[model samples]
Target: MPRSPYMHLPPAARSRTVTAVLGPTNTGKTHLAIERMLAHKSGLIGLPLRLLAREVYGRIEERAGTDAVALITGEEKIIPKAPRYWVSTVEAMPLDLETDFVAIDEVQLAGDLDRGHVFTDRLLNLRGQSETLLLGAATVRPLLEKLLPGLNVVTRPRMSVLTYAGSKKVSRLPPRSAIVAFSADEVYGIAELIRRQRGGAAVVLGSLSPRTRNAQVELFQNGDVEHLVATDAIGMGLNLDVDHVAFAGNRKYDGYQYRQLTAAEMGQIAGRAGRHTRDGTFGVTGRVDPLDDELVEQIENHHFNSLKVLQWRNSRLDFASSASLRASLDVVPREDGLARAPIGDDINALEHLLRDSGISTMAKGPKAVELLWDVCQVPDYRKIAPANHAELLSTIYTHLMQDGAIADDWFTRQLAFADRADGDIDTLANRIAHIRTWTYVANRPDWLADPAHWQGVTRGIEDKLSDALHDRLTKRFVDRRTSVLMRRLRENAMLEAEITSSGDVLVEGQHIGNLLGFRFAPDAAAEGPDGKTVRAAAQKALATEIE
Candidate 1:
């Protein structure tokens, strides 16, 4: 009997008991899952985001001891030789390992246009020997009932109050505010506005590394910073002390197209403003038009569109070859009137790679498809333009297949070229992306003879690029008018500048400060103006030069 590619159950998955745990934000859905996972002798959790995966991994380790849990994401992996509990991003989840329990967080993303296929696949395939928990928004109930007959459905509620606060400007935002935007530029723009008016803001976005996001989140959580500017990525279980969420824009560009967020999405994002034990308010800002009254009311009232069909894609291993798989992908969307896998970017890149007649003609059978898919699965760490990224991937794929190993000099030359920073924000992002790609490649113990050395070197480059990007973002987004050198402006040959009796301080014809009421240099406090102080010898240097 041929099974629906969408529902091709792994043989063992049939023996598991499945429970669909449904809820909105602040609900105890994940909390319950964690409790169950801890209670079970061994367990695995699949999270939609790397950040969320790390969060759960840490919590599990704290309770189960670090060795009991393993963390795996596409770009990073930390695991014991025999991990008792595997915490991983959905695609990275170790399905081959059996555990007493399994849970998939944000299961409703199964209908997500691009990333949903993996979720649906996980929902259909991965199962624990004893228990399997599928966690997500309640909107998925119908789909679950239809797709998984006999599945148990459990619902949970918001632990705190969530309401629609009338839309307003950034300046009027409250403390503990989170300004959500769709694009990096918009996130930065709103964050900068908040910094100017409200001190500095913690910036969070999808492209940031897990470590970077954690540090940024810590800044907001510690009360050192009052506001956070982020993308919709925060909606998926990334908790914070947010009392308000103001949307800088209501629309977003999904990988394929720009579209209005669904009622479900709007509600998910708004729900983040409030948490257990605290009421939260949400609204629109940064010149974005307010959500239509009905949509606003829907989100406020928790009314959302129901899920009908699960979004899915063929993982049909029977495809004769990589070429055949691409052909099927091209035809299936049109044949079925369904969207091609939301996750087709990588495969699309692979197609471009195979465009060379030599590569295209040499491929046939499932083995070829598997090899191509493996190459496609490589992360686009460089985040270059899709075509350019695909071109590079194609080149690398060709080299790896033909040459077995990437040339050391070829890879090093790219890094050497990336050593310079561009002033333009987009260019800096590109450089960071390239370093990230290098870092990713460098981490593969199988790919490099000395993975540790290359990993360290690549990390140094990534860190340099990341720091440069943060510095650029901070300077552009923050209001630092109280001091001159604090702009981190280029240094001058002058020993140091003095504060004028009028309080106008400058060195070498540059205006520096009207001290923000700090005794002594307060150089660290004044120049570094981060909620954290950046110490400088400004005060001591100036005093010494004068004496």
Candidate 2:
């Protein structure tokens, strides 16, 4: 079989030491990896998240001059023109960039349903120039032993002890606690409650930009906030000064449906509480069910399931034509020595593209089809309909064929739309997502004559939009008091006229109902297809201030 290109590296790479550092969370696994990378002249570390990449990049740059380290992710690259070390998300790592030391964080993700194949590919392929280190859960040890014979493995015990203390009320959550929730809305709701009771709380979620996330975490770490409410994004490798872990809800929506968290996942999140040598405790809150006695005992005792097989996907499909690619994807149900991973959006989108006669017809030959197929692999962060994404790509292919460049006019217009920052939360999010697509396009430097300029413009715009969006999220979600007051002010604005006997406000001769908060029961005549009119009470409060 023609395997990954890296497998055929020279004897020097084969002679390098490969260490599998196995352990649970808070085991100093990542710290050990960092130390190894620093000991070498040049290094590359594969992080699981863009936020984590930024964190590591900053740390490495601080220690090893800014020009010595490069950071690369899907939509952003802070790669120094000449870098001695690389910090990158797993998918974005420059495979050809040789290094003295190479480390993969959260190596157990090699079995992840969505990204396991990428992780497994890295595991099977990466031959660092000097040394290679794999850091993650103990479950991966058995598979590593089977796959990489004679590989050295070391299991580290958690620096601090984790004890399951049963369930607790949200009101009873200890100080310096980190509460985990599944959704942004839930995280915000919990943070809002924490603000009311504990004065304030830090908030973190996957959608947040790295700068925003770092600032939010600093609030809790720097003692400005006693509590932190966040999503499972924390389960990866976010370090803070948290003393307790509280589950706002046991069940989390796994991009498919709401389901119970697995033992491994629970252990990972709970492990965040006790960092270093300090003993930590965890429990449930927000009416979530208590952990079963057996599970709780296993958690307190540090027992977790064993890994059986690693999940893998064939991203290295050798095909030049769309039809050949589709056929390969359809027929190759499994690969030798690797288990098939869950169906990803890329495969689904590729199928849709193949079926669409218009898009499929554009790729007249293998070379063209291969290029189009590469474009299809770029994940759509917008989460737009598959058909819409297909149409967008089809148009791009046409434009590329015509000018050998992306339709700069189209991207410019998108920037204008993204620049409109004064909008609701969903509007801002959509605009931000739109700008991200442009950023991804800009990632392909060859696709533009002035690629550097295009990238610089998009980056600045993205930063502005991200800052605006972060401000909105912080005010609407974290600063609950400000949000509530703003709502009150809006309601006050709409109640320009004194509360009429009928409880309707005569604003510009329109009978708008008096909004108690944002919504109100309208009088029979005030009802309309669009729902009741909102009394801008907050604006009224602002007018009083002006008076």
The best candidate in terms of lDDT: 2
Scanning candidate 1 in windows of ten residues, the lowest lDDT window is: 527-536
Candidate 1 to truth, TM = 0.81
Off by over 4 Å in 1: 1-7, 10-15, 327-343, 361-369, 381-383, 417-426, 442-445, 449-460, 479-547
Q: How well does candidate 2 match the true structure in TM-score terms?
A: 0.82
Model 2 regions more than 4 Å off:
1-5, 8-16, 330-337, 477-547
Residue-level lDDT of model 1, residues 1-547, one tens digit each, is 4222124574344425899988788888888999999889889899999888989888999998877889877656677777788899998876567688889999888888778888887887777778889999988887777667667888887788788888788878877899989998888777776665556788888887666677778767876567899999899899798999998887888877899888899899899987787899999884887677898788777778887666677765445777567766554422221245554677667767677676676556666556666667777766557778777766666666666667778788878966775666667677767777777777565555566677778777766766776666656655443223332332333335667776655544444445444544332334324322223435534555445
**Can you give the TM-score per candidate against the true fold?**
0.81, 0.82
lDDT of 2 by residue, 1-547 (tens): 4332256333234424788999888888888887789899988999999888988888889998998888888888787778988999998888777688899899888888778878987877786777899889887887787677677889898888788776777757887899999887788788777665545577888876676678778767766556889898998998888789999888887767889988888888888887788889899895788888888876776677877778776555646677677665654424334687777877776777767787677776776777777677667878878788877766666677667887778767767877776887667767778877777778876676677888898888778777776677566544333223333343444434444565544443444455453345443432221121222432443244334
lDDT (CA) per prediction = 0.73, 0.74
- Model 2 error, position 253 (Å): 2.3
